[model samples]
Target: MAQKIIGMLGGMSWKSSAEYYRLVNEGVRDRLGGLHSAQCLMWSFDFDDIAVLQREDRWNDAADLMVEAAQRLERGGADFLIICTNTMHKAYDRLRAAVDLPLLHIADPTAERIKADGHKRVGLLGTAFTMEQDFYKGRLADLHGLDVIVPDATDRATVHRIIYDELVQGKVEAASRDAYRAVIGRLVAAGAEAIILGCTEIMLLVGPEDSPVPLYDTTGLHAAAAVELALG
Candidate 1:
């Protein structure tokens, strides 16, 4: 069987993008044994530029940028696309329309895993845009039949701050990890059966041990799904 090339639209932080690259390659090697690696292409962005657009709430501009990147991947002969950030999936519809390749949405595999685990209610932790917007959580609810919950406004702000101020910059302080553990506690109190580390960078901060319930890392799940499609 021939492997399909995975196109990664990344560099929303480059830190998490690096994880995606590692996880995808590791997945392929695990599936195919020694000396195997993923067939993949990547077009990374200057995250600073995207950050400015996100802060200004210029979603259309962000969408345009995403479309441009997806087109580049298509022209480079990518078989499918994976936008590496959960927040940027706000522009997913535009990217999907602009490109010929199938886009592997970050939320789909997360939702699927949550459902497969028999979890109907889950908590989400991500950038403010992903948490507060309709693009990600809405899709989980509307398309996947899962009930998604987010942190309160204050916790949401903390999650957003930690992502931009520390995680994205590759800073992983124990204080931030403790803060996230507290947040996860609250979500579990609120009847969340599982937690979705909705931001790719979040896997850097907390994991299953940090929570009483299950923790789903979108980067790992998304990359694993990409490998499946590439190898299947």
Candidate 2:
């Protein structure tokens, strides 16, 4: 089978983008054996610029930048597009509209995995934008019939802080990891059958070994799905 070219719009934080690249290549090697790696095209943005746009509430401008990135990937001969960051999926509609290339949404593959695991209620941990907005939870509930629970006000702030101040910058602290575990435990008590590490950086801090419930790492799930599409 000929490998399809996968286009990635990454570097919402380059740390997570690096994971996407690693997992995608590891997936290809595991499946094909013998020094195989994914054939991927990527356009990594300056996260600081995007962060500035978000802080200033210039979402349209941010969308314009993402669309430009996607279009560049398409022009570079990518068969499909994967926006590697979950938060950026906030611009999913606009990004899709701007590109002719098929986009594999991060939520779709994740919701599928959750449903397949027979989990009815899942806890989410991500940036404030992902938790507060309907772009993510709304899709899981409205489209996939899953119940989503997030941390309360206090925990939400902590999760958001840990993501940006530490994880995204490649700073993983033992204290932060412990804090995440506590938050996850609270969500479990609230009736979450599994925990969705919605932020790409969350996996760096906590994985299955560190969670009270089953941990669904969106980065790994997304990359595996990307590799499957690439190989098919």
Residue range with the least summed lDDT across 10 consecutive positions in model 2: 204-213
RMSD of 2: 0.8
Kindly list the per-residue Cα lDDT of model 2 for residues 152-227, writing each as its tens digit: 9999999999998999899999999999999999999999999988999999999788877899999999999999
Quote each prediction's TM-score. Answer: 0.99, 0.98
Residue pairs in clash, model 2: none
Candidate maximizing lDDT: 1
Deviating ranges (above 4 Å) for candidate 1: none
What is each predicted model's overall lDDT from 0 to 1? 0.94, 0.93
Runs off by more than 4 Å, candidate 2: none
**Local lDDT at 130 for model 1:** 92
lDDT for each residue of candidate 1 in 69-175, tens digit (9 for 90 to 100): 88998999999999999999999889888988899898999898889899999999999999999889899999999889999999999999999999999999999
TM-score of candidate 2 to 2 decimals: 0.98
